[model samples]
Target chain A: MTGIPQEQNDLAYDVFAKACPSRGTLEHVTGRWGGLTLGALHQGSLRFNELRRRVDGVSEKMLSQTLHALERDGLVHREAQPTNPPRVDYELTPLGRRVTERLLALIQCVEGSMDDVLASRAAYDAGQRS
Target chain B: MTGIPQEQNDLAYDVFAKACPSRGTLEHVTGRWGGLTLGALHQGSLRFNELRRRVDGVSEKMLSQTLHALERDGLVHREAQPTNPPRVDYELTPLGRRVTERLLALIQCVEGSMDDVLASRAAYDAGQRS
Candidate 1:
């Protein structure tokens, strides 16, 4: 836990605060495309189309936007190579790797709980019909 | 790491897959309001309005929708008590708690990294202008 004093902590970026800049970064990290993008990059660096394939369904536009936001936030590093037809690769920065470690844990947790989640959804739906 | 066989794992729900149900649940858990809502409930059970306040900027409609998604997914338990004005409270289910444990780790990581994130933003912006 953070040992920072309560008053100092209050001044720190609190995601629960509506106006905090951290909220924006959190959204970028956990956003629909962002999480998937980062998760894909965690394996290794990837080119644009390769990332699109690994993420499965991100459009070129959304992936580009997601990458720009992440790169701006310093969670992702984009390297554009000058070669035949050009090659741009995306990889997680040190900070991004740390964030993704936690994120992948959360992702795997949810993946592991899918059975329970499905059952719960079924029960909830059945209750609604009765 | 999951020891499941690679062949069997391919059949399992994968967030990276375009059509996996786990992807939907992931979206719900990490959605704009979902993460904040679950994070708030991690403290203890809270009434609807209290959740709204704790999450800082959620509108009533969004909060209601977020809770329903979470409840249906079995990450949140919603209790409607019989009392004056009809009390309703929200709390995390066991599975929810598990998910939130990982989530709060990610959230705290983001919160703690705000200084670096801010500095990164400044450097990124300056580079853009140069």
Candidate 2:
């Protein structure tokens, strides 16, 4: 709490507590598909299929669920243009952008440190085998 | 990758790719219990019971499993002291510390924004009902 931004000090929610709403929102934001979805959208607004492609292995059902959760949480905006087929696009809201900024920072850190992690994993496995 | 640190641009592992090992490590770091466990340990080293207490609602089995995954990833160091009861303490490794720093930033962002998130959820649910 002390190290966090000063504005957060007086907030009513504590994610460490079980019943706090913040915990649920936090889970949605950091969940496997949610995080990737947000990261993919960070580049800009993308269509549904574009998102599925960018997120790699996410199934259609999983992607749709992830988007719905994010939109319900007010982190994503869904826009539908009534064209012949009804073109729909998903984009991060202002709040979503703010949250995704922090998420991307975390992603970058993890991606950068993978070499160290792989080496550590190898050593750990070798120890286990011995 | 464009906005990430310059050193990371050339890395072979990309979290966006489905098969990359970084994706698995990222999940372990950001998963519900894994994130909380690391956050609790970030405060300082703690015994198994102390960690369970600090993390709020984590079950014994989940905590044990989380700790094992983190240890395998080299993000956590588990020390078992030979004593009458054989005390075990969990703490973050240097790599874990780095990952947790970014995760805490994301957590703080979400915690501080809970009021907005709650208001958004209410509005969403009301719209659904109407």
Candidate 3:
């Protein structure tokens, strides 16, 4: 897959490559707000307020930015409601669902090792101070 | 797990919370160079230059910073040899191996959907132009 069909494959970006768009996409997928937003949306479609609460600690500006990024990435779909005040709902697209599953799996694994990680940090910090 | 054992759990940070240390650790696990470094180290131990080559396009400053962060987190261990040239090898710690496995899983999933993501971006940009 390295050098095959240079013209065609050249268009396909590799995250490992510094110049690739995939690197940016990867960053968005794993960023702090991005990760939390996906985690919330993974549960179900969420309105603006619901999403804001679900992610916890995310400000309106940050949530808006994260959803915009996700929507632009085609992982999320935003639908506006026909109401006097206007309402918007956010949901994960098929592509978003796939990415969320993988990310959540990683999050779970990290949580799984929380005990070990915390312990290691304690030990490391103690050693560093000595 | 939210409010149980306030004192004990307080010490155990939650990533969802804004002030949690886990959030920073999670970011490191998923950052550009951090992700690539973990992917490379997941395979096995490697010397400094070998690691630099493996995670292509990483500057010496960035790699050093990333490795320092990972080491401080106890996710990576650095072994320096007693040679005149001072050879150094980096490997994933047990906790690191677990985190790396999960992070790599996410990275692979992202790579798996590269086609969809790229196509989505193209369609998005095309639509924005219209």
Candidate 4:
């Protein structure tokens, strides 16, 4: 029997499918610090240190890892200037910008509804106590 | 320091700030199996077993945990049917639906661009080796 790669034939990747590559992309964009980093770059290119400051609490190692992953996924552009002490900058690729805009909107939605969420949780916990 | 809690004064919850509550919601919505589970429930209510099946590779423990977190966040409604063999069904709340819809769109975008991503990765790797 001739072998056929099922994934290519499956019009849309099934993130629900454990082996699907789409899950990796989903995780990359939504991964902790992933969305935030994208948002930071949306304004303009940011140097490594500036990005580090923008995304608080991210260790240098984690920030580097996140940037590497996004770059590999074609969502980020990394530029290292030629100098005695190299200066590196990070910016969003066109595809990344498209996705980042949506991610930011999603974040805005959550922020807008946070009051409702806090109220709901408070009520739920109080009811549980009763 | 004037006793104004900084978070309260910050007009919007900042996920990048690390201390903001929005990060919790973002993590919950985009956490492992979170997006998939919500997408599964979006179609209709699903039982515990059915959800586990729908989100491939999710263990019973993880499925239960994800559902509970979503319920706590007011994104999922869990109904435990009283019977000899108890039945539990999970569905998205209005709040949950709103977030799930965005998550699904993000997933779709990633899938649609997988070919581009694959090509980019291949090129990056080839350049690295050269």
How well is each residue in B1-130 modelled by candidate 2, as lDDT tens digits? Answer: 2365657543767888999998999899989999999999999899999999999999999999999999999899999999987999999999899899999999998988777787788999999999
lDDT of 1 by residue, B1-93 (tens): 346664565458799998999999999999889999999999999999888989998999999999999999999999999998899989999
Q: Write the per-residue lDDT of candidate 2 for residues A1-130, one digit (tens) a residue.
A: 2464557553667888998888889889999999999999999999999999999999999999999999999999999998988899999999999999999999998888877777788999999999
Cα deviation in Å at residue A96, candidate 2? 0.3
lDDT of 4 by residue, A17-102 (tens): 89988788888899997888998999999999999999999999999999988998899999898987889989999889878877
lDDT of 1 by residue, A1-130 (tens): 3466645654687889999998999999999899999999999999999999898988999999999999999999999899999999999999999999999999988988887889899999999999
DockQ of 2: 0.56
TM-score, chain B, model 4, is 0.89
Q: How well is candidate 4 docked (DockQ)?
A: 0.39
Compute each candidate's TM-score over C-alphas: 0.92, 0.93, 0.86, 0.89
Chain B TM-score (each prediction, in order) = 0.90, 0.91, 0.88, 0.89
Off by over 4 Å in 1: A1-11, B1-11
Question: What DockQ does every candidate get?
Answer: 0.56, 0.56, 0.40, 0.39
Misplaced by over 4 Å in model 4 are A1-10, B1-10
lDDT of 3 at B2: 33
Poorest 10 consecutive residues of model 4 chain B by lDDT? B1-10
Per-residue alpha-carbon lDDT of candidate 3 for residues A63-116, written as tens digits (9 for 90 to 100): 999888888888899999999799999999998998899888787666555656
Return the DockQ of model 1.
0.56
